[model samples]
Target chain A: MSGASTSTAVIDPYAPFSQGKTIQLSSASPFLPRYLASTLPPHTSPSHVYNTRLRGKLLILDNPLRESRSAQLKQERAAKREAEKQRRVQGVMGRREAKRLGVWELRKEDAKWALFLPIHHLWLGYIAELLQLPPPPSDDILHSTDPSKHRLPSVPGTQAKLVKADLHGSILSVKRAKNADLVGRGGIVVHETENTFKVVTAKDELKVLPKRNSVFTLRVPVYAVRPGTGEEDGGPMWEFELYGNQVCFRSSERASRKFKFKETIEL
Target chain B: MFIDLNVPFPEPIVYESQFTPSKKKQKQKPAGLTNAHASTSAMAVVPAHPLERLRVPDRKALRERVEMLIHLGYTIIAFTQSVQSKLDPAAPVNWFDGGEGTVFRDLDPRFNGGKRGVVQLRRLNVVLDEASEKGFGFNAQTTQLLAGYDILSLTPLTTSTFQSACLQHSLPSSSTIHLITAPLLPSPRLPYYMKHTLVRTALKNGARFEICYAGVFGDGARNWWANAREVVRAAAGGRRDGHEGVIFSGGAGRVEHLRAPGDVMNLGTTLGLPHETCHAAISRIPKSLIIRAETRRTYRAILSEPKLVFSAVPAGAAEDGGEQREDGKGVKGLMEILNEEEERSRKRVLEADDAGEGQEGDGEESEPSGRKRRKRRRKNR
Candidate 1:
């Protein structure tokens, strides 16, 4: 009995305080289990205090919990790195596909050509570029008018000028044509021959319109010098209705012909 | 400006008398040549028929139809042809050949004369039916070919197709996809798949929902009305969620199918759309669509500002050094000059008003007191 008591006392330092009592004072303490469990090594079994006491001393220097937490962090970082690589690869592939499908080319070309041009003038630039012709001269003089001067006719002899001037690059709108085909169409003059004028329509279709029997109203932006003022007069753009049947000469030949300007008298 | 975005090309008219013998007999009777013996004798006298009788009246009919739309105050009309397959890309496209003495010549006789409002032509919607996977499969080549068209629309058969299209197109990145909302026959209500959430996503992607009103004029008026009501409900939801991507258009095939801007607006109101939104659906929304289409087709065309061309200055102005000042000038000069001129005019008007007030004070001193007394009486009452 004395040897057994001595061994118990050596193994447990608090054995002398808890003799034969069923309810010991140390068992009721809140800090005992929590502190022991926290002090125990992560790899050791947590349920039995006897096993922990046996193995806890050997594992005291080794922090298995900290090692496990670090390993888990490394695994998470690798997954994140993999996801980032995948995203980058996807981005590159998308760009390549866009280029292959001409989407990139379209966007780039559009940006390069349309960067400096205005929207309303897009048609003019488009037709000019397509037909390999210079765009129509800007209407600086006509648009430079004060509100009061806007009501006055900017170009007094527009009808006469239209009949005599070169009709290249002029915007033509069909007013009245004996042929039903030339009634409501409008386009920019691409090429003018003796009998027919090639025009690029708004839809970008090239059409050869015969210059016979069609009544065309041309919107020619003209700069008119004010009489006696010696200053450039800013006026509204001029629209003149001319009978195509009257002018049968080529655009180049029209400049030399002294044709009578017969303006359509609107009833 | 009102825009009728979908008008199918009219079929060539075939004269009934040319096909049926019964109609020929009726025509002969009307001409007082019912007697078979007399008719035979007349036919022998003039073996060659008159040129007028041989002429086709289809051109006249088409012209009249376009004119009727113009008279009804539609400033723009898009003649849409639905694209069915890859083999027929140009099938739905109709190039108005008015300039080349084709059938469309008389369609807008006064268009260029500056006598009426401008009637701009556009190819509105190119419908892609993604119902048949084999026939209407999304082909990259076809999409590229359709780039020539202004607006491209997709009509998905199933909800999954709609979602897939939205996912693939990335509607927010490109404003190319136009959602067509036509009446669903037999079942007028919105399909279960067309959920509010899906519509919200589409709206977020910059996809516009189109409401074609031509279906209202035909036998499917009831169905169309029901469909339109559901669309309005969806639009209302979108509006509440701070999105406005709805557009109203006339998908008119014939002249009788066309409606005035006011009438269409009234129809929109009946469909539960707000007054302002209804007006915008026809005018502002369609205008933006046209601009988007134009930009899509023309690479060199930008929609930022109006393009200006520099006309040769007058010799006199050139000498005055005004031309030099505007040599490298852009939109800035034009806008600044106009604004300065407007400010000067406004100041002059104010000065005139001050002078007029002085004159009025001298002319009528008693009238001013009477006016003040009347004002005091109104205020007291």
Candidate 2:
């Protein structure tokens, strides 16, 4: 509470009404509208400044404070934030594990990889906004006959997709691997570690694929419908092969890593 | 699409006489610098000095020439380096280090997000003489040495070299050589007769003949005219087979010699090449040649279009996202038919259940009949 509002708590013995009158009629109270005493005929509203009826009863109005208003608001905003923080789901790591998804079977009571569809949908929305991917071509634009208007955005080239773009939530399959068993197993990348990717495969089994002499085929939607739409999809996915040898850093580290063009023969 | 595939990287110092160097160390330093970068990059093995080995090209002059070519709207430009004899796989040097980012650092014009930047290519032109006839180093061991270059061409001075260039060294996937260029400057005539069989075979194998416009602007203009005209007639003028294997390039040794792409196409007219054909010579013909050369990275030299196979779409109700519409209108029509069939089959099944209500409910008999109906539906689909 400000000093002005707090002053109301103390009672003046001689003139209780004068104390209230001072709060509304002092120089600081110019923020409120002023009434003309000369225009009043008799005694409808009480006399504000003179207090002609009761003499020898003087009161002082409190001063207006600039800092206290903002201070009070700051305290309320922080309290609101603390309340919001309490609602976040807690996990083994910490509170933010609210973002972490449970096993696919536990999610929908089905062991099928399809159970993690909601998480996948959330990931698509996350990646689409993160990459600033352009909106999908509308039905009208797709059916348009004019070739000149067919403008596919040129930003999502192979270099941008492979070099440093985050691959945490993208769908990836092993195109080739040193261990022949990992030749074709692919799924949504649930957890990305330093040198291995913890993938949730279509069979709903988690596969820890090492980043050795392995080549991963990544399919990014050319135009993906943002999540929450009636039918969310990766409308037209463009396939790119990422040599595992090139990307071996952790997900956070890869964001700042620089990749140079190596000799084609070496691959 | 406009490309000058033969911009020669000239030596910095060209002595008054063809022969002597001031000292051998000057030549050796550049060669070592080249090999260090080349071994890492995919470029052919460049020998210490080739036929034009007397002078090292001017770096400033080459940079200025390429800048001028980019301003002239040449989106793709290959810095041409010629070798005297066959490359030794044992001690290979890569002289193409300066054509790309390192030398042309900050060279890109900062508009359109640099998407229209020049595609700097490294081309090795082997000036095939009698010594190279012994061996052009087209062996399996030379893949590393030869793979360094993007476009490989042969300047055949003899009939035997010409025949080998067309027949043997034309595998774009395995072997590096695809372009066949001859010295069409100041010669009394071509060193060998232009055989029809040799020209057709070379064209069929995707080998293009280049006529350097830089040669025409010099003192050899007269000889260039006759030679260029003969090459064009031999390559594209004969029958209506759509054989346009001849390409025009700027073999500019100095900055002043380079010309714009449109002006070069116009000059090709003086050599009896039609306007449209000459336009393709600089644009579409070389574009396909350079793109096909990427097949060198593929196994068994197989180059084909790739099709996208979407991960399987599972049971419809269980899917999160909508299923893919595989081509546009045709798939929609197929989907409509499937929807109508499902409705009709569902109505028939309901009617069958109603009719069986009066009869004794035999679970086994009904199950077989239902399985048979589903089987027939699958066959119809």
lDDT of 1 by residue, B64-100 (tens): 6678888898766665545442233222222332222
Clashes of each: 8, 11
Q: All candidates' lDDT scores?
A: 0.50, 0.62
How high is the DockQ of candidate 2?
Answer: 0.02
Candidate achieving the largest TM-score = 2
True contacts kept of 2: 0.02
- Candidate 2 per-residue lDDT, tens place, B1-381, comes to 587888886643222122234244236446654444434432333333332222334655666787788888886777777777776444544565433322343443222223435656678888888988877776778776677777788998988988888777774446757689978995958888778888887787678888898887768888888888888888877665745879999888888888888898899877776777889889878876775565454332211112232333421121222223322322122112222334465679899888877574676678888999988965873
Provide the global lDDT of candidate 2 against the true structure.
0.62
**Candidate 2: residue A44 Cα off by (Å):** 99
Per-candidate DockQ vs. reference: 0.02, 0.02
